[model samples]
Each structure stands twice: as structure tokens, then as C-alpha cells.
Target: MIRRISAALLALGLATAAFAQAAWTDAEVRKVDAKTGKITLKHGEIKNLDMPPMTMVFTAKDKALLEGVKAGDHVQFAADKDAAGEYVLTAIQQKK
Candidate 1:
């Protein structure tokens, strides 16, 4: 009985963690500076960051994250605050 209760609790924890994961935001690319590893975007509200819709620049966590992206492209992305407290683009993909 104790083992079953523990297993149930573990599963619940895992499910909650998955559900709490950051959501992707819709954005329009305003510029991509591969040289600086930065992208400017006019983006919708970033629910995870509690940010409202606005145009802003974000450093890409990896230069590769800028690949295939260009100005005027519609994309979906996820961002997070880095150790420096600056927003960093963590994931990005061209919208279908």
C-alpha cells in the first residue's frame, strides 16, 4: 500500500512538471543577426516570462538557433531569462 501511494505521488509529480513546462510563443522576426547571435522579434505575450506583446531583441542561447530565420518570417519560439537576467532565445522554428 505504501509503495502504491509512493508510485502514484511520483507519477503525479512528473505529470505536473511536464504540464508546467514553458509554452512556445508566436512571433514575427524583425531581424536576425547571426554575427551577434541575436534576433529581434515582434512577439505575442510570453506567458512564461509574464511579458506583454512587444518588439524586443533577445540573444540566442546558441547561434544555431538563428539558422534559417530571417526578417519577416513567422515563427514559434521559447525563451528564458539567463544568469545575466537577459532574455535568451532557447528554441525557434519557422511557423507552418
Candidate 2:
């Protein structure tokens, strides 16, 4: 029983690590929502190894980071998967 419990914990740790996201690019920003810290981004095509091509709205962590950016500006951004597994922007920079 102890061995099984250990194995289960190990598996859980691995699963958590797998879900912890590294980073991603937004490609472009379509809209900015400061009130809720959500951004509508026209992102580049993302073909995840475990998923398929898709585009959607993303919530960013720092709404202030979008100060000078506009709907048309291209940005190289990074995101982290939230508790619910939805992508949330964590870092970003304007792409010249």
C-alpha cells in the first residue's frame, strides 16, 4: 500500500509539471480590456503537439504591460496555464 501511494504521488507530481506551461507568443493584439485584464489577440497559428490549430481570447496577468500597445501592434508574449488550464499571459514585449 505504501509503495502504491508513493507511486501515485510521483505520478501526480509529473502530471503537475507537465501542465506547468513555459511560454507562448501572442503574435498580435486584437483588443485590450484593462477592467478585466483580458486581451483579444489575433495570434499566430498554434499547432500544439497534443492539440490542434485554434484561436481564442487570452487573459493577461499584467494589464499595465499593455500600456503603449494597440489593437494592431504585434507582440511576442509568454503565457502560463491557470488552475483551470486556460492560457493566461504572463510576459510580453512589442515586436518591431
Candidate 3:
């Protein structure tokens, strides 16, 4: 019974680790509005939110997140809904 419990715990830990890794989605910056801390993205599946591919605007968690990136740049980003029920850009990185 002890061995079975240990195995279960190990499995649970691995599952948690996998889930903790944010599933980034491919996107292209369609627009950026620094004043409003929002960016428009044409993106593929956002796995964390179960959202299908689409083009939409998202508020960045911080306006500075838009720095060094601009319209037409291919990027990878992660987004999630904030407590205010607004979609917030959590991570963004330009694609090489």
C-alpha cells in the first residue's frame, strides 16, 4: 500500500509540472497601443483558455510588455483572463 501511495504522489507531481508549463501560441502582432496597454494579435490555439485560432485585441498585463515589438512581427505569446474578465497578455516574445 505504501508503494502504491508513493507512485500515485509521483504521478500527481508530474502532472502538475506539465500543467504549469504555459502552452504558448504562435501569433503575429497586428497592432500595438502602448497608451492603452493593449495589443492586437492574430493567434493560433490558446490551449490554456481552450480558445480557437482568431484575431483579437488583448490588454497587456503591463504596457512595457509591448516594447521592442510592433505590428507585423511574428511572436509567441500567452494570454489569460484577468479578475476583471478582460483578456490580458501574460507573455510575449518575438520569433526569430
Candidate 4:
């Protein structure tokens, strides 16, 4: 019974984490630095990274991620820690 309970708990924890990480929150582009593939965003809850709503700068996995985005644009973006140990954008798009 104890083992079963532990397994259930573990599964629940994993599901919650996956759901959090998969969710994308809204943000406003404060700045876009195309040369460096970085952008400043004032974002809502980033549960995947355990970040609260705030303004900060982040690097993108690909420079092209910033190609058509500009300052003051509302966007939805996914961010994750890269192998280099920096949090970078995995995906992004302009909000409609």
C-alpha cells in the first residue's frame, strides 16, 4: 500500500510539472537585440521556469527567433534552460 501511494504521488508530481512546463504565458517585448539573439520581455507567470511576472532579458535558441519581432509587441514564448546553463527562448510568436 505504501509503495502504491508513493508511486501515485510521483506520477502526480510529474504530471503537474509537465503541465507547468508546457504552458506558455503572455509577454510584451520591451526590446529586441537581433545581433545577440536576445530580447527583453515583461512577462506573466513562467511556471516552467518558476518565474513570476516580471521584466527581464533572455537569449533565444536561434537568432531568427527575433527576426520579425520588435519592441512593444505582445508575444507568447517558450523558454527553457540550454545546455550552456542559460535560460533561452525555445519558441516564440507574435500575439494576434
Candidate whose TM-score is highest: 1
Cα misplacement distance, residue 23 of candidate 4 (Å)? 2.2
Candidate 1: deviation at residue 24, Å? 0.5
lDDT of 1 at 10: 100
The lDDT, on a scale of 0 to 1, for candidate 2 is 0.71
Model 2 per-residue lDDT tens digits across residues 22-55 = 3455577778877788877776654342433345
After TM-score superposition, the amount by which residue 32's alpha carbon in candidate 2 deviates from its true location, in angstroms, is 0.9
The 10 consecutive residues of candidate 1 with the worst lDDT sum are 15-24
Q: Which regions of candidate 1 are displaced past 4 Å? A: 1-21
Put the candidates in TM-score order, highest first: 1, 3, 4, 2
lDDT for each of the candidates?
0.94, 0.71, 0.92, 0.91
Residues 1-96, candidate 4: write the lDDT tens digits.
999999999999999998666668799999999998899999999997898999999998999989999999999999989888898988898886
Q: Rank the candidates by lDDT, best first.
A: 1, 3, 4, 2
For every candidate in turn, the CA RMSD to the true structure comes to 3.8, 5.8, 4.5, 5.8
Roughly what TM-score does model 1 have, to 2 decimal places?
Answer: 0.79
Query: Which ranges in model 4 have alpha carbons more than 4 Å from their true place?
Result: 1-21
- In candidate 4, position 25 carries an lDDT of 74
TM-score of 3: 0.78
**Stronger candidate by TM-score (2 vs 3):** 3
Looking at model 1, how many pairs of residues clash?
A: 0
